[model samples]
Target: MFADGAMVLGAAVLCGSASVVLGVLGVRLIDRRISGGGRAGMSASLDAPIQPMVFLFRDGTLVDATAPARALLDRIGPPDDDWGRLMRWIGPRIPVAREQMQQLARLGRLDLRGGEGQGAATLRLLAEDMGEGVARITLCDPQAEHAGIVVDSMSLQAMEEELGLLRTALDQTPMLIWRQDAQDRITWANAAYLRRAENRHHGALGWPLPRLLESPRPVPGAGTATRRAALEEHGQVSWYDVHSHRTGDQTMMFALPADAAVRAERSMRDFLQTLTKTFADLPIGLAIFDQRRNLQLFNPALIDLTRLPAGFLTARPTLFDFLDQLRELRMVPEPKDYRSWRQHMANLESAAATGHHVETWSLPSGQTYRVTGRPHPDGAVAFLFENITKEMTLTRKFRADLLLGTTVLDGLEDALLVFDSHGQIILHNEAYRAIWGEGEETLCATISAWEARIGAGPALAALRDALGRAFEDRPLSGAMAGPGDRLLGWTLTPLSGDRAMLRFRAVAGQPVPGRAELFEAVGDY
Candidate 1:
């Protein structure tokens, strides 16, 4: 019951020979029934083939398989057209199988060894050409040629179903998966991985499929690590997030698509750079804080306006800390007390959170800032600082000039009235109101009263004509009767900017000053 060299048999015979015998007998009985007992002599003659596991192919099709070979095919679970199926299984182990199988006719015979498989053993294949496009492939385990073992049909069938289920799941997943040995050699790959390898390697794809990712070779027993890698095809770059998990003496790798995530991250980085360039040239100081009240962004103007160092600003201080820094520099208005200052700051933050808020800060250094707080997206806030010192100074100077002019005009004793080019009265002194008796503040009544006093003479008529025209820049003088019958000298003068001024004085008695030597200082401006 034993072969001559049985002592050199492998564990495959000790573990699986009985199952192979049963599988061969079952296939032979079915064949005999189908061939109507006519092929009994042929079946008897070839019941046992060479190599314990052999396949006979004529015209690239399987015509016969040995007993051990039929058992292996049963385990692999392929249909009648199993040449392609056998090639796929052998590819990882014997990478040259597909390439060299085509050259077997010219070469006559070939032998190859595959990578290590389960139970820490290598598989061997012997291929030979029988001429005329006919060939035979013999797969043998050197350590198990003389041993035999048994397995029930129920157990085998259950194993086949479970194997099919697992294969389906692995092939159906869109992710690329592969296993590598301790030496970083690819041992096996799934359908997705093969598809990618095919696209890259094209017709040359076979055993141990080509590596698709430039991913880092994971160190042995380093646990799991993830990284991103790039793959280029058809001039378009694709990205993947590769995960490598190390187990035992091998590493299992998975790669998922990351093209979208990479693009989004690139876009966000470009947007921030653009915003930084835009903010660099702004004149207004800008500081932005996030929802947690930490300073997230600021412009160069903020550094210049606040006089803060770039290093400190880049450190990303909290809002209160930033305010404290500003306070140390006397950049904010001096507070009433420490506690009240803090309370005011809290109120400012609350107000800014709601919408728009504004505060004017007058610093001890005499710089005035118009500070505006505006609400931003995602519960963030932005502060803008604009120096309004020059504006404030101009406004104060204008108010002072108006006050000095009004004081001088009201102190005048001579009556004065000024009219715009449209004949509308714009300015009148207290003396003019006193002379006209507080009626309508109009010029027509004053002219009529002057005519009544002066008897409508030609000189008075000329002065009236000059006043009415309101365009001539030269002065005209005339006399009107005073209350005590003294001569009241009146002047009508056209001023700059299309305005007219009428003045009245005592011509003989009121010459007290040097520039008063000039005609008729009514309001004394």
Candidate 2:
């Protein structure tokens, strides 16, 4: 709709149309020219439309004038078609007596010369009569050049064509373009805007434009504004790069879709959520540093392990700042020389880049940590902290048990040997090894009981049989005669879990020959 109660024809004309106040008549004139002069009495041979320089109503009142006519006519007085007013406006140019001035409307041709030495302007009047003494008049000037006033038909055509192109562009462009009056009423909207708001209750023209959005608030001041418009229909938010400016009493706005950027942000948020879920259940404390060396991510274990304040972690401190906080918390090792701590951090970063950073930090609280740094993609670094104090303690206890067992066995007067379920020697003291003529090289190397009896003679066969029965989960005890009339008592004791221990004692009496002699020697021992 135009100002001052101007109405357009239909919805099609209004939907995506631009300012058409001055263009409607121009379009009609072009149509008349294209249709071979549709005017009833107009000549078909005319090359152009009949554009009147002045329009006169039936009551002899001035209606409108072309720009050139307006400019030239303003030199005299306000243009009025009243015969007396016309005579006064034209004044000396009429050359008719003041008494006969009323007949000027009936004149077929009027040679009107503007003020000064300008040539005369010839106005050809075409008068149409309506019933009951009313007439419509059109004034055309062929030789009109008042003060260099000239109309270029080609220029007007070019301008009209450009206006058409601009209107079409506004309607067809993907961007949402609209105009709103100072009262916030949506005066005009392009096709894109209408489509975007088609589902809304008050999306039509003449409605308040702010109602199209869930939260429609104007930007403060006279400058342009950029913001997103969250559509209420689907719970989907659309990002728009808005541009606004004032045109007289109206504010024009243009918005471009920024959906890709908005979606990317959403995707990043979801990815972080999944990553946080994964990191939450990890036993190892985890910390990730971004390209800027800022601590971007941390898990609950990290807070527990480092003993740093949760507030500090939430603030996204830089890597160096995080390390300094850890140092204050005594989570990491205290620096050898506190003055060069920063340099030490730099070294740590360098080593972490190559994935070689590993250290054990023994804190003052008697807790030990195995800290390692690894490089991730995109110039990021990840740190892992593991509490290894219990593991280290268990390993030390096991090593002490093995040492104490070995010392006790070494101090025994009796020779002892132990075999695993596979019938291979596992534990043998020096006494056992010496009795079997074995050396230190025999330890850990696989040796069967048969191999241990190589030079012990026939009685050793009985001892080997006892050892073999122990490997079969049976325990046995017997005595065997050794060299130089010596008697030895052997016992095979089956231990838990498919293992057995063998003990041998030197008999003090004479050599035992048979089972009876061996039993008597065992009784004596």
TM-score of 2: 0.57
Give lDDT for model 2: 0.65
Question: Model 2 segments beyond 4 Å from truth?
Answer: 1-170, 177-190, 197-203, 207-229, 234-237, 241-254, 258-264, 274-283, 339-344, 356-358, 434-456, 479-487, 509-525
lDDT of 2 at 207: 27
Error of 1 at 365 (Å): 2.6
lDDT of 1 by residue, 333-426 (tens): 9999989989998988989989999999999999999889999989999999888899999989999998888778766867678887776777
Give the candidate number with the greatest lDDT: 1
Cα-based lDDT for every prediction: 0.77, 0.65
Q: TM-score for each prediction?
A: 0.57, 0.57
The whole-model C-alpha lDDT of candidate 1 against the native structure comes to 0.77
Tell me the TM-score of model 1: 0.57
